[model samples]
Target: MSVDVSKIVRSHEGKRGKLISLLQDIQSRYNYLPREALEVVAEQTGIPLVDIYGVATFYRSFSLTPRGSHLVSVCLGTACHVRGGREVAEELERQLQIKPGQTTTDNEFTLETVNCLGACALGPIVVLDGRYFSKVSPARVKQIIKSARAGKEEHTADGHVFPVKVSCPRCNHSLMDFSHQIDGHSSVRMTMAFGGKHGWLRLSSLYGSFNLESEYDIPLDTVVNLFCPHCHAELISANVCPLCGAPMVPMLVIGGGMVQICARRGCKEHRLDLNGVNV
Candidate 1:
């Protein structure tokens, strides 16, 4: 579909400096930046093509090429890494036959990696269409993908479903976990997996593949950081609140998991049990 690029550019009020915002708006509408649209923006805003391209490449959030309908983001942070994130990634690549930063042949799904999802307790998690799945295995990956293609709802007769939660200290918003807003129109969530080949956080049923494990070259005790996808706040790395700079305290939830809330009382920029918080 050929979009009216000039209109989108006008949304920025023809401000040449708003190229980044203009591009973000266009990407949200089309899922990828079209060269035609970019050219139109250049013509309307008098911004050079080189400068616009620079901004697009500078952000990992921007995709120059077309993206699939379904985005599959796998987490590769210290916790998920230690638990077996790499193997899960490999399994996804094998099943989808597409590596990280690639899309399936039919353009049904795109597989990519984020550094972390902060659901350490739910290591080895897999998110599909913003929903979370904990303790995923390669075999389970196959089932999930197949089920999606076949238009079957995910009925984990053998797996566990845990909330992957996150929060924003800046806005006091319970940041959507595994979710990152790329453009203004739509937001997406990333899935996380373990690395060490040993995890099944809160499994309920017996899906045959939950017990599967793979070997890895890296150690499981690596350190990492978790950032808020919304406001880009540092939720877990320094053990301090990203908004107020107060120390964070670990508090237990109603069921069983723990969360790190801002220690500052008045500036309680903290949220709880919201999927994908700093784990």
Candidate 2:
């Protein structure tokens, strides 16, 4: 499996502050950052190999070693721990036959334990390929693994789509527009600006659904800035999208958590943090 490190490097040739993005692209292509890829990146970009390694190690998302096709992360944070999180992890280990931080012999799955995924309210959470499973149990672990083995997409009993009501993180004003519904739920309304065009955008309030309507045609991969329609405060969060390294647009989940979606058009990376834990 030879990776075209040169082509990857050429894509970001003159772009400043693209090291993380460059590494992300490399990892996305190979499933993990190969040592040869890193070396080639350093040589092509004139960045020291040590610096590249530093960037790789600094972010837990970047992996220097080979990873399995599917990633399974079990939360062991205080909230999850109290809710039989350990038991869930043990069940995953039993089913997958791999300990934490180890990949299965078949390279199908890798198990990992993280301190927190910021969704403490949904304790005993298991994240498979960035999809959050709330209140995961030992029995559910088997189903999840089975689904992964069969390469079948897992959907909740009700089609895996659930509605959420969000407010502007800064102004606390409700962003839900009942007058305009999407996916049979109130749409999340926000003002957006991209490519010198400013207009209103409505997003499906469903956490897992990607249906959205924008005033302007947003080109795929284009990054947009989002603002609260009420207070007009920018909704951009400091956190970057784990999937595409794009700026995350955050909305306060009405009850107790925050939901963030990638600002880049067509990137289906969204996060739900019910307990507001940073990590």
Candidate 3:
């Protein structure tokens, strides 16, 4: 459908950090983000199409395609997952006859499952529109669907927060729980980085290089250093490889945290703790 993206753009002139608001307005108008509108936004705001699309795709609230009148968000967070949230999702898929990230044929609802929604105590939760239903059972899927279609809100609960999941850049393995321990001294800052508010990663058999994205005058990787296998991007480092004497790649363990690993082809198993960057 044709949307007047120009109107949205005019209201959000000088579109710098207001990308979220711009996308939200567009979604509110069309019920989803249309490609044409995104292109128009890129043309008017001088932002790259990639950047616009990246922002739109990063957030859970934003939709790249058309949506139904109602949005059904299911929480599969850690706290929720341990409490039969997976079964709840499965029941929803079975009852609704639709998979996650799919809209119903009749355009009544859109099904999407998120990693976390906080509300740990309220495990196995299903959210219709914005209302939360806690302690959901597999048997209650039909009832919940019926209630939503009947225009009646079900039980709701406040949401809570949880830890982030870290992954390897090359293989996308989670590194949240580091099983192997090092006997070296650990600072408070280092502890905060491994389990903080940013992102999580799992680098069991892989190596991490320096991130190189620094606020201060961080130096560049020498010509002798290797690049990341996933992107071939120059690796960043604050520490050197103990075995190879090469620079180890730097990565965010989480917010206020950092990890360095040797990115050499045969040195993928090298994982080390480096100095933490102050947040």
Candidate 4:
């Protein structure tokens, strides 16, 4: 059924400030940029439909079509590339029978590739359902997609799903409060644009070229702190840990730990030989 653009737009009082918020709310309700909703947004804001669409499309965050039940994203960032991100992504596309920008016919899954997710250390990462799976490989891609399709289990890299409460490293406040990934894997769309956090991870994929941004100039991806070095323990971003309650220290720990270096076997966490002693 077509969306009632006028009604929806009118529902929002002509408060210009509330336009963006209203659109976000509406898009959330429909899980897409409904034609009717766009009409409403355009008419209410006195903005041209073309302008509205332009805004929506310009931002990588917005979607124009209905999303699938599950979202699957493969990282093509630099670290992931060095670790075979392209291969993993290709494998996914082959299995899903859909390209990066297309959704499956049944709406079961939508597959896309991102330049990076700020987990460069976790190259070749795959985020399914908003959960990050690092060091992904062709084999792992198969398993991840299978698990998601099954819906009977929560697929995780290294075959382990730790109940970690992810948060922003800078602000100790709850990160989930500001998190906007809608259905995890079903909602994320990846684009390779220069001067973004994923620039390093997107060097090879020159789908389109533009002025190159500086290495450090780009926006750094989310910094995850207070995570367990081992076991992928869910740690809170507080000074005194939430689970252990120990004085939290910022440690560069991702992919579970040294044993589980990343989601890939090649980068499997290993014992560090410090001073000839296995530490």
| Comparison by lDDT, 2 against 4, better one | 2
Ranking by TM-score: 2, 1, 3, 4
Reference-based TM-score of each model? 0.54, 0.65, 0.54, 0.53
Backbone clash count, each prediction separately? 23, 0, 16, 13
Tens digits of lDDT, candidate 2, 181-239: 99887899999999899999999987789999998999999999998888777776545
Better of 1 and 4 by lDDT: 1
Candidate 1 weakest lDDT stretch, 10 residues = 200-209
Most TM-score-accurate candidate: 2
> Could you tell me the lDDT of residue 130 within candidate 1?
48
Estimate, for each residue in 1-279, the C-alpha lDDT of model 1 and write its tens digit: 334666666556723235554665576568788888878877777779888888777555567788887767666668887788778888988989998777888999887776655457677766665445677776788888888788665885222233333223233344332232222111222111234343211111111112211123223332223333444433331234668776543222222122444434344344321121212
The sequence of per-residue lDDT tens digits that candidate 3 reaches over residues 97-216 is: 888878899999788776654346767767675455778889888888988899887554332222222332223233344444222111111111111232222233222222222112
Kindly indicate the candidate among 2 and 4 with the higher TM-score: 2
CA lDDT of each prediction against the hidden true structure: 0.53, 0.77, 0.55, 0.47
The CA lDDT at 39 in model 2 is 91
- How many residue pairs in model 2 have overlapping backbones? 0
| lDDT preference between candidates 1 and 2, better one | 2
| Model 3, position 149: C-alpha lDDT score | 93
**Model 1 regions more than 4 Å off:** 1-3, 14-17, 152-279
